[model samples]
Target: MSPTDILRLLLKNWKLLLAVPLALGGSLFYFTRHEAKSYASETTIYTGIASGYSLTGNSESDYFRTSNAFDNLLSLIKSRETKEQAACYLLASHLQLKELDATQLSWASLSRMRALLPAALRRQLTGPTLAATQRNVTAYASANDTNELYRLLNSHDPVYSVEALGKVNATRINSSDLIKLELETEDAAICRATLALTTQVFLAEYRSLRMSQTAAVIRYYEVESEKALKRLNDAEEKFLVFNRDNNIINYYEQTKYIAGEREYLYSDINKIEMQYAGALASLAAVDKKLAGRGASLLSSAELLRQRKHLESLNTEIANQQLFARQQETDAAPRTQQLQVQAAETVLAIRTTLNDHYAQLNSVEGIPSKGLLDEWVKNMLEATENKAKLEVMGRRKGEFMAEYHKMAPLGAMLKRIEREIDLTQKTYFALFTSLNDSKASQQNNELTTNLKIVAPPFLPSQDKGGKRLMLVAGGAFGGFFFVAATLLGMGLLDKSLRMPAVAQAQTGLPVLGLLPAHPTHPFKKTKKPAQASKLRDHSYEHAAAEHLARQVLRRVSAVPARPFVAGVLSPLRQEGKTTVVQSLAHSCNAGGLPTLALYPEGTDAGPANDYTRYYSPAQATLHRWNLAELTQPRAADVQLVLIEFPALLEATYPVTLFPELSLVLLTLKASRSWKPTDQQAVADLRAATAAPVEIVLCGVARYDSTDLIIPIEKSKTA
Candidate 1:
């Protein structure tokens, strides 16, 4: 459907459009007429969530954290517990008042409260003071869920219920640390009292929660710090015990000293070994110089005894020197004494050797004294070096043993020290955290900065009612509802209500349109002449004549005589008989010989000279042949208009299609076109070669103006 059609449809249902909205809007206005006047009160508080100072010092505000904090504040304000406590306080304050107190409640509110609360119950709950009454109320409310006090708090009472207090609106003011709270109620005192009590209760709860959180953190840190300290002490104690048990007093330094002494002892041993080797070689050469006579002379007991004593003296001196060196003490005195004794012994040995070899000749013909002296000195030096080497080797072995023993101690000590260092670090870190938590706890206590900047006050004027807005909203809501319903119906409607729609639905050309006139063209009347005159001047008559002229023009195109045109409909009661009768009468009046044939059982009105009825079975069997079914008509008849039964109600006369020159598919403009109608029209077109056209019958006058000439205009022409 086009936009114009939609506009036309809405205009056509203008009465309904006006009626529905007015009814709904008026109903809303009437219902809200007795709505109580609302009084609103607001309070402003400094939340200090974004830029607050505390004991911990000021810091840059984080956008996300600040937003979350504000969200938490708002949520707390609306929390059930907070609202319930506030409601309890307000209720208690109201209950304690024996008479009207303007500061606490209005006259109207006091009366209502008295009506809600029985005298006996009110006395049972009330106390001497507001605080006492509040305590009593809290205790009574905690008794059970079904208790009167608890029920009052949970009920929908405007002053005492948690639900009523939930109306308190809390919001952050821009990006600042300020928050605004608002509430509306039937009474000014109730609005102010409710907002004030809610703010107080929420702030107290928020502070308590923050303080508890910080305390919990502090406690956790303290516990962890204690554990860390215990671990550190254990590590230190283990280190001390390990040191005491292992006899380790500076193990690294002791091992270092042992290593140095061992290196020195090895050097000394190596020097002594070289000296012993040189001495032995020199002694052998000296012995060779003292030939066979020298050996016999040296065999004397005195010489042997002196030589053995000198060797003993040298060995004793070397022993003293080695001992003194290892002990890290002065060995010069002992070494000198032993050296003197060894020198005396060497002189004596020399005297004996000289006496023994006085007349012995040397192997190279040299004197025997020099060779004997050289042998004696080499023999003593070799003996001393050998003894020194033995002593140094023993010392080196002791030093190596000490070094090996200290090696494992170094690793054990390192491990203990590492453990101690790690434990100490952990303990210190936890201690620092504990201190920070304490500081934060203190900061939290100091920064409970929710201060009411604008306390709520008793409202002097009542807030405006929403009656007008609700009425307007209802009216607009009803209007749109009706429009949407109409739009949906129009979109879903399949009725061919217009000539263009009929042509589209049927897939056939619309030859003409017929307006729905009150005067039935085929109805019988007592005064036939007057009925005919009335029908002649009707718009339906005029439209039918126009349709008949168009059909005759098309029929004239065919060269066949007695052109047969069948008028068919998809269903009964679609004005097919009227279309057929009007077409025949118009054609006959226009000087064209026309014959109209309708079904035998159909109500086609009294037969006339141009109209006749035929049996449906005969028509179907004989293929609608005029001579076979109807009485013989005038030979000059140029057109035969046959009105067939509804296609959906009876079988279509397919055999009659060969004889027809044209088929007019008549459809009711006010009725929907179904798939059955399209199927019937499709079968008819497929069965015959004749042209099929649509005549949209029973159209409103406004819809048919474009297709048919008006009766006035036709008469003037």
Candidate 2:
């Protein structure tokens, strides 16, 4: 429909609209009457996640770690375990409040019991102080949130407490650490008190758990450090003892000493060999001359060895001298030291060789006794050389064995030193770790990083602006509710309420709108025949005259002559018979010779159902057989008003019509005609070529008396 059409409809329902809003106002007042005033408060807290943590690690981190840190904190806040603890604390507070309130209630109940006692007895039982205290406690409970406290404390189920915990809302703002937590309740004090206590419990638990974990780690590190220190000490002691047993300082220098000893032993053997050889030569000469006066003794192996050592030392000294001369003082210190040692060795070996040569040269030609002495001396010297050679050989073997041990002893010593070094490094590392752990533990012991930058305060305004919003919303809601009820009802209703509504529903032109006749409120409506027994009132008479003119005009517009219009409806009690009787009276009175006929075998019976009536020229009423209705009409009748039983309810064959014009008489201002009944009207139109118009009865009255006409008062009792 166009907006104009909607506006017109609303205009027509203006009075109903007014009535609807008033009804809504009354309903709102009732609903809001006993409701508690609500309050709300919010708190902001930075969870330190968005700010980033002061953790000991690489300072720069991934965005996921930075961003999702608050998400972890939010989980902590909303955790079921945390909420459970909050519930316990809140429940305890509720119990305490309930206890205090219960005392007052108990006193009040006692006072009431005392009041029922005799007056003198009541005076004896009651005390002024007790009564005043009771009144004050009761007032305190009433003014505070003690009613909810009482209920909570009295409840047997723990589920109530669990459900109560749901009141807290922990909201993260835009996935950041900025959290807005709120508690909503009828009482502001309860909200504030509960949030404060719960926050304390949560902080204490969270901090304690974190610190405890750090402490455990610190203890573990301390144990490890102690173990490492012990291993370091053991390794160091093992290395020291090993070196003492070997009679060594450093393995490298000890090896050099063993080599020097071997060289010296060989040099001594050479010297002894040189001296012994000289003696052996002298003995051989004596032995050869004994027949030529000669002695027969041999030189020792030691003398031969000494002679070779002396030559080697001399050669080594010469080589060192040549090297020293080339580089001079610029020679390496180690090389210079080697040159000096070689020179000393050369001097010792040369002196020993000269003494041995002198000993051999000093042996003179001997007399018999002197020669014998020389022989004995030569043998003795040879024997001494032999003993010295044996001793030198044994000493060289021992020195050689010691030299062979150098690598194994040095390896063992180096291994112990390495173990000591590694242990010490480990111990130091563990110590550093222990210190770091202690620092971390201390840091953890500090307050939790979550800081409530802004704590919640007692709310100044009621939550949600609920009262004003509800009132305004109720007004808004009432408007739509009223619209739906009125408009929806209007659309769903197929009954004729106005001539326009009747025409719109059936697509039939409305002939007239007739006002309802007044009647006693408690009296049931009489049957049509009984109703027709009474003379028509002035309103009915005027309505009949006004409607008849429209009907005749409508008939004139149609191609069919002398319209034989039947007053019909889909169902009974739609005033079809009444319209037929009235229209017949009006037309006949207006000098149109009209006959009104009720169809045969219908609920409309014979004369027994009719009241005797006469107009100056009334429409003849009949209940004719079907065959007679099909016969030729009488010459005097100019118009015919036929009445039928409800067409859809009864089986009226469509072919029964004989050139009939149909007037569908639908009741106005009633919800009587269903959409299903309109099809019956369509069926009637399909069956007959004559124009079908509708008469809408009992419309709402509007005074415009200019078009009304007087009707003849022709009724007789």
Candidate 3:
């Protein structure tokens, strides 16, 4: 449907639009007029759990040195135990009453009993200091002899629970240290008191928890430090005992001494080895000389005596020659004689030595001096050298034995020294670690990081107003309800209510349209003439005039005599007769000669009168048979609008269409158009060669383009 048709539909049903909104909105506003007022209070605290001071070194570091502290604090803040305690605190401060004689307590009774408590006791019982008195009072009406009512209040349930925690909200602010606690309740004072109580209770719990956790951490450090200290002491004792067992004041120093001695012994052994080699070489040389001396040649006692005498004579002669050469007289006779005597003694000694060998016949003549010391004096010197060489060889052999024996001690000394160094390092490391742990434990005992910043204060404003919200919500809901209903009804209603729809559905042109005119539904007992006079013309007149002009445009196309049009609908009471009545009046008013006829109605006044109307129809109208309609029409009649019984109701309806030049299918525009209407149009189009056109009657008044004025709903009906 077009925008114009929708507007007309709304305008025609103006009562529905007005009634739905007024009924829904008015009823909502009235019932919700006295809604409960609420007041909200807020308090804020910051968690020190995320950041803290370093007690050990005081550089503002993470003192707890743990991952769980921050998480634990957040859980503690929102835990059920905390909420229950907060609720108890609130009750103790604000609603403490005498024992409940009844299952439920009244405010008046509470107020009366509240005066009996001492001021100090009341002050002490509120906030973080809530006493055992509150526990007993709250437990009075509890189901299991526990304060389950206060617990109920602290639950997250929307109803049947205490709303202290239910109405309260706790949350951490984004990217900040602050935690916010908000409480909203119907009673302003109660909400304010609850806010104070909850924050105080939370702080109290926080302080206690912090103390306990800190103490636990300190105790752990102390125990660990003690263990480390004990380990250090044991290490020191082990080191001391090792030194004692080794019989050394300092193992490290003793190891250095032993190392120095071992190095000295190694140097001495090296010198002795060189000396021993030299001694061995000297002994070999001495042995060679002894072999040449032929000690065996001197083995005989007689030879030994001769050799001794010769040695004496040679020494005396050598002394006399050395004395003569030292004399001042160069050519002295004595010097010459001494030289001659020395030569003579040397020759005699050799001759005697050779004679002895010759007498023994045991030696051959000796080789030259290069191969042997041929002088008797030189041979005796060689014999003495061999004796000294043998004594030195024996001494070297003893020293070598000692060098080999001390070689393994150097390795044993090095091993002992390494072990002593390692023991000292272990003791030092343990002592240092133990000291650090002790300092940490001490610092933990001395430091505390948690501190409260602010307490809860009274709220400045109450809760949100309900009346405006209710009114706005009701209007919105009512609008949606009406829209949904329109949608549902439109989905169910298949009738063609608009001209555009009828044309689109039937595939026929709507030549013209007349707004629906509900006949004077009020005059139940009126005669035909009286009812006709009473019918209103505001919508009907304007609709008929517009439709008749449109119909004439098509009728004028034929330019034939007796221009006759039949008006029909598929259903009874679809305003076919109304369309004809208004159409003829409209034609006559437009200066066209017109006659309106109802082919089957007996209610046309005065038998032959076509100008007089019956009970419900307005305008001069007449009834005719198919014979009268086909046989003759007034010579003055330029247009004749014939109204037929509805197609579904008419018997012999085919005979009524013989003289028609055009067929106008009239239907109420406000009513749903049925499938039968399309069939009826199809039938009429098939039955005659006349052009079939639809004229929708009773369009509503909504726009300047809408051709029909809307008829008002009866005020009484």
Best model per TM-score: 1
Give the per-residue lDDT digits (tens) of candidate 3, residues 95-212: 4433543222235434543554455645544443336656654454343633445344645533224444655677666644567777776555566666666677666776666567
Ranking by lDDT: 1, 2, 3
- Write out the backbone clash pairs for model 1: none
> Model 2: number of clashes?
22
> Number of backbone collisions per candidate, in order?
0, 22, 10
TM-score, cand. 2 vs. native: 0.53
Model 2, 1-717: lDDT tens per residue? 445545656776778777777677667766877767666667787655544455453334557876565556556666656665665454333333323343122343334333433445333323355444334323432355545433443344222244555667877787555778787765565566556655665666767777888788888888999899889888888887888888778778778766776786688789988987988888766565444322221133444454355345434443444335422545456545654654554454344433443222223443444454555456545645655566566666777788787768977887888888888888888899889888777656542556778886776667643555576667668877877876777667655666666666667777665566632212335575565434244555556667878877766676645567767777767777667666766776678777666655333223321211121112223433333553455566667666766776764434435457655455545755576777776777677776676777665443213233334433342
Model 1: what TM-score? 0.68
Better model by lDDT, 1 or 2?
A: 1
**What value does the lDDT take at residue 189 in candidate 2?**
55
Better of 2 and 3 by TM-score: 3
lDDT of each: 0.82, 0.59, 0.57
Instruction: Please give the lDDT score at residue 567 for candidate 3.
Output: 79
Instruction: Sort the predicted structures by TM-score, highest score first.
Output: 1, 3, 2
